[model samples]
Target: MANRCLICDKKKQVGVSSRHHRGVAGKQWMKRAQKTKRTFSPNLQWATVDGIRIRVCAKCLKLIKKEQPKGNLPEIASK
Candidate 1:
């Protein structure tokens, strides 16, 4: 698995480490918080959506709301 943020596409980074008493010591490897690749629904998992594998974001997963139809029609009124 690659070290990358699925949402923002942030990449892994390396930084220097230092101690309280001692000065800069050595380089330390760091990576962005990773999101689990797998999910409860395999069909929804993706890396790209432009006709390819794409990871679905939380906002996209939100349930779509249905709006009530305007102008009561006679056909619908009977029902």
Candidate 2:
């Protein structure tokens, strides 16, 4: 399956991870701070919509569950 949400089209996002350390003198260690590239992937899961199984993000799944009335599933429009 694709790493994308069928409902909202949420996908992987690029970001940065920063690590900072303090010096022995209790001062800011600028050289010791490092930044690394990272990726933020969506929390995708399998869900059945209209009898079709597809992957959706957690956020969209929450909305879908919230909009559902009792045991009846609502029609979710895909993007």
Candidate 3:
């Protein structure tokens, strides 16, 4: 399955991380900082829309709930 949200088209995002050392003179120095690979994925859930099952993010699901009076996830409107 695709690691994405169909309702909002959300996908995984890559990021980095690093660290620094504190200097003796009350200062911080980047002596040897390294970048690390990381992924940020949205909170997704299985939802049925228009008789089709699709991966929808939690945020979108919340919005759908607000927009829908029946509290049922109908056909997800596309952009």
Give the per-residue lDDT of model 1 (tens digit) for 1-79. Answer: 4443344443444444433332344532242333334323222334333233434334332211111143321111111
Steric collisions counted per model: 7, 0, 0
In candidate 3, list every pair of residues with a backbone clash: none
lDDT of 2 by residue, 1-79 (tens): 6799877778999999997666656555645778899999999988866678878899888877776656555455554
Q: Pick the candidate with the highest TM-score.
A: 2
Q: For residue 3, what is the lDDT in candidate 3?
A: 85
TM-score of each: 0.26, 0.74, 0.65
Q: Which ten residues in a row have the lowest lDDT in candidate 3?
A: 21-30
User: On residues 1-79, what C-alpha lDDT tens digit does candidate 3 reach at each position?
Assistant: 8888877688999988666654555443435466788898889998766567678899887777676677565455453
Which candidate tops lDDT?
Answer: 2
lDDT-based ranking: 2, 3, 1
Using lDDT as the yardstick, the better of models 1 and 2 is 2
After superposition, the stretches of candidate 3 with alpha carbons farther than 4 Å from their true spots are 24-30, 70-79
Superior by lDDT: candidate 2 or candidate 3:
2
